[model samples]
Target: MWVPAKFRSKVLAEPVRRPQLIEHSSDKNKNKNLETRPQQHPILSAQQHSISQELHGKKPAVFKMPVDYSKWDALELSDDSDVEVHPNVDKRSFIRAKQNQIHQQRFERKNKIETYKYERVVNDGLLKRINALLAALESHSADADKRSPDELMFMAIMETAGDSPNEAPPPPPAGVHTQEKEQPTYSKMMAALVDQVKAKVDEDKPENRFAAYVEDVKSHKAKVEDLQRQLLEELDSLEKEEGRKITSENIHTGFDSSHVTKGKAEDKSTGEAKKSTQKAQTVEVLNPQALGKPLLTKKSDGQQSSGADADADEPMGGDDDDEDEVEASELGKKFASIKAGDYRTCLEFISQHPEVVAEKETDGLLVLAFNSAIDGAYELARQCVHQALLLQYCRALGRDGVRMFFKRITTPGHQAQKVFFDDVNSTFARIKSRAKEIEKQRAQEEAEGTGGVEQIQLHAVDPNTTINIQIPPENSSDPAEIKAKELFNAFPPGLQRALESGSLDEVNKVLGKMSVEEAEEIVAQLSEGGMLSVEEQIIDATTEEGQKALKEFEEQEKAAQQEQAAEQAALSKYSDDPE
Candidate 1:
């Protein structure tokens, strides 16, 4: 232990004795009675010397003397035994202690994180396994009509949640009840989902304004009506204009009234010659416009001279025949003019909407009804092949010959056999599959209350709309008719009827009375009517119904004219004079 510098004075002030020494100096000590003053030097110097002597162990001093701190100012002091004179506090020890604490905290944090990670991994793994199992169950349930899926899915989720450490199992949503423990089918799950959706919908207040919806529907109806009216009016105006021009032109047209008057007069010499050498069966027939009557002959005797003169001029009568040829040429020209006008009318309609007629550039207007469908080329080609093959097969005389023909068609390097039987079969399969898909899709749409005959419209009007539907070619070994029947069966009869006839009303009527498949059969008839229908269409348009009606009108006009003439003559001859 070391004492403080402030207490050094107290320690030095403690009572201490100094040794007395007598010395005889040669010139000093005069009187014995006088007290001999100790031979003293400077008091401060003496004290310092004594301290030095003490420090150097030169003085004969007592052992208990107070230590003088006046010259001992170089040393520092401390009181506590455990305390030491450090340069600074031991920062290294403090830093080490803090580091240890931090390390401990980190270890705890690491343990917690690892535990969380492990739980997460375990939970996630369980969820994944459950989801996989549910997916497999769903796949199996897709074909099972007897079971449902909601219970199984719920059980799966619950069991998976129970097995997992990180999550607590969820109860079903409020108002939902789980079925008794049993495996559920896909259909049941779907039904349950539908019920859940219905419940949700019921809970929601409709945000759509009913008044706005009504207004929109009304507006749409008005627009459709206006468009239809405008188109009809335009058609009527065109017909009236064409009719006026035709009627005005017909009044001055000078066609012959009688076929008899149009026949060429025969010469008397030719008549006499016909009587002599003409074979009855080989007789020169008159022109079609001439009645089957024989040609006019010359008079017997009184008119003989005139006949001779006429015979002389008969060679010049050939000029008269030129008139007939000229008239025929004029009629042909007239027919051509009429045909050109009709063609222009059609072309103008097509040109006004070039997009609709675009398909015509490839397949011509005969194949497509609408401009929008350009992609159905593949389907159309397949249909053509099927139709051709079927017709050929029917006329092939025997099955063996048909098979041989089919084999020949399938042979390699045959230019026409580029599309193999397998390809055709595959295409047919694709079509069948596609048709089934479409059927399912339509059914789903209907279930959702969103389906209609919209798909049939594409097939009817859009030639470019590819129908994945296909049938094997007739020459194929496959039963194409059977395939066709299967495909046809998938569609509603009403849809089929609509496709066959251009009339939607007929389709609607058929739908009202029959199934969709039945209607489709009716429509298939339209496909069969193809070329024959085309021929009939051409003949019907140009037939003479109008001409017959016009003839009756003309006869009536002629009779009225004759009656007026008779009335005027009667008035002039028999009526009383205006006296």
Candidate 2:
């Protein structure tokens, strides 16, 4: 058998020993035979003497340590005899398949990494261009009209040239083919983008469109950064997996694997320590008073009541020596100490202390809290909870508070404020629609004689005032009384009181609660009943009925003016005749 070059040295290093057979003869004859055997050569006799001394004397032979061949096990040499393949399959094809699989995996990983890098580069360039354009616009806002569009585009290109020094030029127009296009020192793409922005400003004139463009670029940059971060994480995972495979192979290949194992263990421990530290830091940051106490308290009937409800149930202007006075004072102080624009902190404080929401003032604070909750940027489920809590607070504050909230949010400010206000406005409109639906359902129930004796709290004209009326069950024997009661209930409690008091201011205040159609219907009903006197009705020209009413009013005013003039002329003629 032919020995591999790697094992040839080991095979030749050890000599084979053969057992020698001794002839059975008399001792004298054996000595005579040895003497006659031959006069051995001088060097051979010396070597025999040394060997005999090594075997029989106290001298010992040198011991050699065995050579380890385990390191070679990791080597995927083509001459390896231990690799087994299917008897029916070709070995070359099997190896080729494995190579192709490895290549494909590597190609995919590289392509993904390259894609993320490309996206990151593109987003970074876009962000830089937007920042440049925004800076230029803001710096020259006063002289923006004085500066030409071409000059602005040039300035934008110059500002971004340093970052993307080797930016590629724009592709040639269709139908024009060239081997090599002229490379410009500045980016053509950035110039084109600037032109597009200028065109948008001229065409649509969106309020500060460049600033919005900057925000969009930043958002895209953030997405690209996230993708890059994920890509790096995947690369790190791949490196770790490769290291583990190498370490596993090293174990069988007689290589030192202790260092890799130790490093991995140390890294794991460090990660665990970091997690524990982060958890402790997070716990330290949270307020125990805010987090430990539940927002809703369980009632005796197993129903839960929110803090706003509980506060509402308490009598106003209570004694200063109340047991909860100190806590309430502390909460108020905390709320006051919160910085403006810190909506999240304000929201948390309001949630923990619902009494703040029930106060007559603090409409601005409640609006900010509602904005923070329903801003549509946070988690959906958490946002829903926040919205529900704020809506409950709105209910606790009543119609006046809601109106104040709407007015405060509607005041012109940042674009984000407008968006938040619109969302809130839509939310309130939906709530009002829902209330109408409920009212319709209740009316139907009353008509069917299934009305219950429920106590309904109606918000009055005054912000501080609320009227709690008990809805009587439909048990009246007189049909007229029932009809009167139904009519009385048809009008809002505030409107009913306003009509009875005959106060225009009170009527206007109650009318604010009704929609335009409902207010018109109520006004017409009052006029028909002779409860309200109308000299002239103001009409909105935007509506067809209002337009027709306005035309008739104008015609009537013109005819009256002509009649007054004729009377003046007739009086003058009588005075001239001296009658």
Candidate 3:
């Protein structure tokens, strides 16, 4: 067969033959003969081998395939590549700029992660410290004599810090060590950090940032506790869900066929009894009167029987009665506990039994506790007011209850009680005076058909009017009046006009729209200006003049009682005479 040119060399080739022996000759002649012989090409030799294979009917020799290493040649080293840069820029500077940009990106990422971690650590430490201080305060453990000076200092700092963010700590308490004294390493580190931050921010040197931080933490305590409670509730719900899943899985997969067989057998044995028991239970649930009645069954003798069942039911009734009696006794004991003037115990009791604040039956006990707290030692009384929980108790007492409580303490009994009553009474007087003034203005406006609206005049004051109407001042020539004038001038023109209208209702409307602190400040100024005064003041019995006044008051009371008795006796005599 004729093969294509591509395969011609392999398909048609000369066959290998044995070399013939040469005759003996001189060395020069042999070398000349060897040189003169023609050389066979490689392609011709390969074709000769293939032809020999075809002729011999033997398989052609297989050659191993060569591996291409050109793919590896495409890879270029990063450093060896030439970079394109602007003609004006040096290659080294361009390379350095690229390196710096990459470095800056990595550095910023590292710094962000590090800062987050640091803040997390700081917040965790702060939370721990706040919880510790709150627990100490709540449990009254900080007052213990055995506590260290550092503990006392820490408590004082946290307690005495003002609500304002820029407020400083009060002076160190007696028996407490100064900041320079030895403290925990953590506290020292925090102090150092606070100092560094203050310095960097150019804050005042006298400000105590650490104390302010503590105060801020304390202010958000309720929110933190609420979050913790929510987290705990969520965790509990998740656990319950998991438990339900496990229970359902077990119900579906854990039981064996033998258990079903046992259940069926038991049902067969107790089916009639179960049906009768269910019927009785249904009757008891449907009929309210049937509650607590023993289930009676008809005996073979045709008589209904419930001998042991009735006996078994008696103890349940007795248990309920006993529980009611025990609860009543416990409530009575709590009420009686406040009669002793122990404010601490009273506060503890109120905390444990908050129902005292809400229950009408405990109103008397609540008042008694408050009176006892006021009558107790000065420090204890102050501490009672400072207790955060006490504010809730006071609010629960309502306005009337609070007024009565203050009235009871207003009596010249204890010096501390009187002092507290005076301060509270003054504030109450200011609020009441403002309320009364607003009411009076509203009444006048209603009478005049103005619908409680004070008409404002936009025109300027007339200087040439025939009637030289002098504006009567609220107070004249008194020191309080001078102070009031100064405060009035300081007010904005609109507010001054409202105040000048002499309709306190308008002033109240304006104040109502203001911030609470500003309103309070205005009210305080009004009070200091003698515009709000207590309608009544109790005489101080500790003074000599008060003692004489008391005797005169007693004589007057005796004379009035005698007159009242004489009138009653005369009326009784007339009635006895049937006239």
Candidate 4:
């Protein structure tokens, strides 16, 4: 039949699946897109130009448009059903057709393989035997799901031999024994199962899981309720103990009803201890040591207490027995700290409560006096305890605290009492003098700083050492010079020469030969005569005091050296410049 070109054009036109919309902005934009098709990519043009240059050494024409093979292919294969082709579709070729066509050759080559395989199976009777065995196994096969690995394998073997019970395997050739090979089927199946599952039977009880969860929840709730009750009871008891009265009505008033337990809470510390504040009148001080510090303390001096006529013998805080223990401990610490020369801490304690200075110290004089004498801080201890005596004095005693303290020391019946008192007067005088000298030196050092004249280290006031009380020689015929000459004449010839030459070690040796009193009298005479130098303090360099003194001396020497060098440098510079 001959078709009109108009009819053919209408038939070949794209089929209209949807109705057209009225021409709006979007429709106009769609029409504009149909006006022109873009050219092949410019990058492809550049690539072809570069390729041409690389081959022919020059740029060539722009890339020619690639022909669309889709429509052509569809047209060519339209009636050829045998050729599998995509209609009206374009597909890009990733790989070019293989020139050798090995795939088709390989396919044709498998034809002889199948034939040979069939012949081999038939010749060996493998296929027939396998099929017959399979039929027999299927007839007697157990359910696949219930069969174990061994049972299944045994069935397989039985089926292969037609269920022969008495057929035994032939003995292995002399040295060649048969061994079982691994079964890949079990391994693959187990691997698959392992991947899909996790072993968690403890948590995975299938039947009682929900019941266990319910029981656990009930137990937890009970535990929480019990804990809540305990907390509430504790809080109630604590409130009562702390002086906040707990009445029946207000027992659980502060706690939330929702969280409150039905039973009482156990107490912390005492199985429901009440607030300790209830015993407010008891005055429970944790450390009476601190309490004693604020009550009555004294400085280490013979200084009179402000309350000398007051009851200084009795312990403070007498309202309780703990006061006695506390006072003793405080006094003990004070004595130790003072003996150790830790005046800083003693001053701090006084600063906290200055009123402690006028409080009871101790009743016995021998205690403070003996301790002071033994600890090598005789003057300081005596002074402190004397002050304490004044503070601890009873108004009814009708006497000075110091006098009363002395009376206690010199009581006739006890020999030990005399021992403590006998040395007090003599030791006091020397220590007082030495203390004055030390105080003067310390004050001068503080006032002058490092720029002051060299310091004189004072020897400790003891029986063995000499006390240098050098007085300035007045008019060369001074009393000091006369006294020194007399002392010199009195000494042995060896001592006289050693003294004249200022050999301190020789003088010490000479002193050691005489009794302490005789040595002291001679040294005193020499000292009053202005014989000793300022720098000759007996220093054991191995001792801490000696080390400190040596260090100071070294620093002073270095300073002097620096000053001299500076002066020399100034003089040299002046000479060089004439300025």
The prediction achieving the highest TM-score against the true structure is: 2
Error of 4 at 468 (Å): 52
lDDT of each: 0.40, 0.50, 0.46, 0.44
* Model 3: per-residue Cα lDDT over 66-95, one tens digit each: 999875553423233278888999888777
Ranking by TM-score: 2, 3, 4, 1
Model 1 over residues 192-301: C-alpha lDDT tens digits?
Answer: 43355334434553443222222333443354456545645654554444343222223564765754222123433654566555443232322221211112122222
TM-score of each: 0.12, 0.22, 0.16, 0.15
Model 3 residue 50 lDDT score: 59
- Which pairs clash in model 2? 71-253
| Highest lDDT scorer | 2
- Candidate 3's C-alpha runs over 4 A off are 1-83, 86-89, 107-116, 140-579
Which candidate would rank higher by TM-score, 1 or 2? 2
Best-to-worst order by lDDT is 2, 3, 4, 1
**Model 3 RMSD to the real structure?**
41.4
Q: How far is candidate 1 from the true structure (C-alpha RMSD, Å)?
A: 49.5
List runs of model 1 lying over 4 Å from the truth. 1-93, 140-579
lDDT of 4 by residue, 1-579 (tens): 777988988876956442233447757855775335322333457565466444543334555888786643322111222443365542222112231243443344344344333333322333233344345435444454465433543454455565333233233232232243332232233233222222222356545332333333344335445655565565455444433322223345465546532222332333233334334334443234423322222223332211111123322221233233213333333533453234345444444433344434443333454445445576665665543443344222333443454455446677634554445455455545565676677678788884332222224443224444343343467665766665554444444545655556656655554444445555666666667644445657999987887787678779889999999999887796755
Q: Tell me, what's the RMSD of every candidate?
A: 49.5, 34.7, 41.4, 44.1
